[model samples]
Target: MAILSPRRRRSTALTVAAVAGATAAGVCLAVGSASAGTISGPLYRDPSSAVVRWVAANPGDSRAAVIRDKIASQPQARWFANFNISTAQSEAAAYVGAANAAQQIPVLSVYQITNRDCGGASAGGAPDLNQYQTWVSNFSRGLGNQTVIIILETDSLALLTCLNSNEINARNQAISTATRTIKSANPNAKVYLDAGHSTWNSANETANRLRAAGVQYADGFFSNVSNYNSTSSEANFGRAVISALNGMGLSGKRQVIDTSRNGGASGDWCGDDNTDRRIGMYPTTNTGDSNIDAYLWVKPPGEADGCRYTAGSFQPDLAYSLANGVPNPPTTAPPTTAPPTTAPPTTAPPTTAPPTTAPPTTAPPTTAPPTTPPPTGNGCSASVAVNQWNGGFTASVTVTAGSAAINGWTVTITLPSGAAVTGVWNAQASGTSGTVRYTNVGYNGRVGAGQSTNFGFQGTGTGPSTASCAAS
Candidate 1:
């Protein structure tokens, strides 16, 4: 998100004599004070919002609730719930309904249409395009003008060894068909084509796939849907892809990249265990570029794609361990330390008599001086805090500004060596090489002074850590 300039106010009353008197009297008056600010409640910050409340009330697994809360508490963050078609459909309906009730726009992932696992790890989608279209229609029906962001399918465009040309074409066709159907159903909805991040697909290759997949029919393309690449690299790569798409007659088309998981880019095809890739970029508003729309968080924090041993199961203990930077169930030993000692003292001095001098001839009572207000905490300030869980880590942040209520603010998180971002929300992020820049979208307005807004991201990494956040 870009920053807006502050407006200047014109002064009305300015008397030289009054100014002199106030200065001479050493009085201070308040001026340029920021307006009242607000700190969003933890509950309000949850990305899942009312969806979590409803899910909590009607519970099965509390893990979902924990994940939802983590997402909501920050500025740019999101959660990914990988379920079978039946479950995905049901959850999609519930989320849409909840979003409607709260009058809040929600982001939803359409995960069950193709070979969902990219031919590995998890179960695949429908066997054919016809069946996939039906599923797409079903998902669309549930969304009734409720704002939603759809991360179509993950890694579908990936050129895998097992995926033959025919199979790939069939999958790409299904994506194109689904996009067309969804847009026709709900014109207001925002759709993003999953481009498999910078690591999987090169700029030219990804653009061709997007074109073949009929990207023009949708809002734009989506990159890094579920991978762990940083936002900066992704943004640069995405810009390249968008340029390619534009060259292919899809220019001026907007695209969104998932920042949820890629605070840092991976060094190899399969993520390494010795990296500290984490960032604090958030989603941003429409940039008015046809090639890019917004960077978004489409993955949830703390949800494991699959364990080091097991493929795709939710391991809470592992999740917590990774998020908090502990080695599994942490040891119980305390460190040894030395005890403290004593200190020294000092002496006193004598007092002097008060001076009795007639006060200078009373000038007209001096006026008070103008007050110097505290620094404005509101209008566009950001910070990034990183935490480790299981084998992965996440970054939390807050962005604030005066009276200019931030719909959201975008910041880029530079990850430490050997780290990879795995998830994010409230913003769209893209990058590689241990750096992710998050840009906020759907920003409402002026975030008043003194108030701070929060956002976060999650990723996988290894070893000693360091992270930083800055406006993009």
Candidate 2:
């Protein structure tokens, strides 16, 4: 018999909450609304950050164009240019101006200066330190305080395992110099250093890098950028790193995280494409952590980074699958309790010896009929529903069980055909099985039976054709 993986058998329950209260309270409740609990800090709003790339990649694809228009139509959604300085300067200038003209903030990812594109698969930067600094200086010149959130060089510090000590040091220096240059140019600009996700770097190690990179000079460190992990885990991990930084003498600092892609955490180190996850609704509000400034959408949904576990390179079907939780195979039942046994009834011998011959021929006494087995009770069941409204999607689900309470579970959805998931919440998605599978990352292992929790996702898609639910 095929048994579902333990992680796959647990059921998922979803719940959705509305935005209410003051700005601060709204922020707190919005972030806390998910199953992993609330995250701290203000929510970053950026919609155009990924649309440009989608348009550029699929110049002729009508679906991409439609999604792009949908994204652009939203006043809250704005674009940011992420490219090597040499390639992005002109485009960045145009976008920056457009964003300012529209009275919106443009979130930019400054690449090219560091040794980016060096490692491959979202790797490689400047070949040398001086060159990296030069590029950042030029990149900073283009920003004229138009309100931009810069996600400086992702994985540059954490990828040290793939580099030598000297190389790592050089990269750190470049990042520090770049941060200083950007701040000097635009004091009003919100610049956040990329501190890879929690699973990748421990607090001590991440703090050490932050210190080396001069995190004090900038706002703070960014975590879970361009990765698929829930905000809860990221928040916990982010808090630990912030605490470590404070212990290292940098206290009361603020930071931000990229909630763009992590609707779910990666099931493995590599090659787990579960696309049902999407860009969580924009402006996710504040986490309670004083150090965490905001959760921003940096990675556009549906765009693939070359790893193809799904179709269309990005796999809309997989994205839908992940968005709607897919059922995993079943598992062995828990041990059952045994009932007590009764004592045997006493038997008596026949009294009459003279009738012994007749007694031997006597008929046996009648016996009571056997008891019937009890009806099997319903096992835990959960259902997640998703709907497309305006330029994004909303998700909700219900959980039921006979013997357990739904404490924690993951609900993932895959994007339908012609739809691309740009963001999600309380879950994560990556390339998997020719589709994207969204799974609850931090809360996946915690949901108990019969308990229900709800989450929401905001992204550009054809909306949801069908939404399903499963445990695990």
Candidate 3:
């Protein structure tokens, strides 16, 4: 947390689960996204995240619904900010193990560098550089031999203005050692050093510091973690850094941006609560940019910046404001007829891309994008298409008119006991709890013969469910 008196920063791995390649865009998980969105790969969703836990414990909380849909349902990086070596090792193991079980890639951050945050509000780390290396080594052992992304310290390079040359050299040495420790233990682990944000330092300066800090041995560097800079701006900044790195003979390096809270205007405020912030794009590797590796939610929304609340603690109001009116691209409404759907309308990148066409007539053997049996009931047929990552899932229900036309449709979905709808769109829900009932909204209710319409929802506590539907 730099005291530039403006928005300043920001931590937190899993194995390469087959599911790690899938994104988690909730309502934006419309049809035809399989090849859609600038996003590439998917990241793991930690079920035990602050927002998920809060939503589950306070299922009836006033803000649970919005928070769950907007915040909890997406994949978030897990931080190992504590200095305790033993606890951190086991914690890392458990998280990566769970992600491997779910077949998704996990993102992690290691923030235990000595004298972190310039002794600002979020200051504190390992007692010294040697102990920090030991901590990172133990932590890396837990990464398994699967694909995982590790975001190193947030301000290690960007905030070097306060450190003397000797101190900076020592910190850079520690970073180099940590990178070697992580890569040696598990080559599958992708380690990203910190480059801060676009405004903090010039590209050349950031590149020089990154070189000193050992970016060559890591995956690349990350920008805007725990900051409020726009994604586009961060991407451009990343390009500058990459160009600079290339000039330094560091080719083939790519970067990931933290889109956790940069949906609104960029700012320089740090360590204080700001209500105008909004969650940015969902995490994805399909950034559509060659230089940019992915767009990630490195900083989980709602966690305080150490001013309004303790840093890393959940702040419900802040979470709500960040999630409120999220900027996800609009999804297509149900069609008038039920023929196989074309790609739904897409504005830009998707958090979790969904299949545009109808679910395969026959189920595929693969497990990542969990699809349901071909379904038809009463006067209408329904299909449940679900794409889940780690703890949360997004599903689309395509309802088709039968042999005859209908004026309206009602669909019933049986959620598992602990499952609930965190958010929904393209239809109105009867209740978020228990067996939820869904009905048509003001438009798209009418269906010509063989016509079709659709709706989608985001959920927690469980994955996809069987749905029964009918037409009026």
Best by TM-score: 3
Model 3, runs deviating above 4 Å: 1-7, 11-40, 266-272, 327-472
Model 2 lDDT tens row, 201-233: 467877888888878887777665445555665
Question: What's the ranking of the predictions by lDDT, best on top?
Answer: 3, 2, 1
Candidate 2 regions exceeding 4 Å error are: 1-88, 264-272, 276-278, 284-289, 309-472
- Using TM-score as the measure, name the better of candidate 1 and candidate 3: 3
Give each model's clash number. 103, 94, 33
Model 3: per-residue Cα lDDT over 135-234, one tens digit each = 8888888889988888887667765544678998999999998998999989888888978676556788889989998889988888877665567667
Give the lDDT of residue 393 in candidate 2. 35
Higher-TM-score candidate among 1 and 2?
A: 2
Model 3 C-alpha lDDT versus the unseen true structure? 0.64
Tens digits of per-residue lDDT, candidate 1, 320-360, equal 32233311111211111111112110100000000010000
Name the top lDDT candidate.
3
RMSD of each: 26.1, 23.9, 20.5
Query: TM-score of every model?
Result: 0.50, 0.53, 0.64
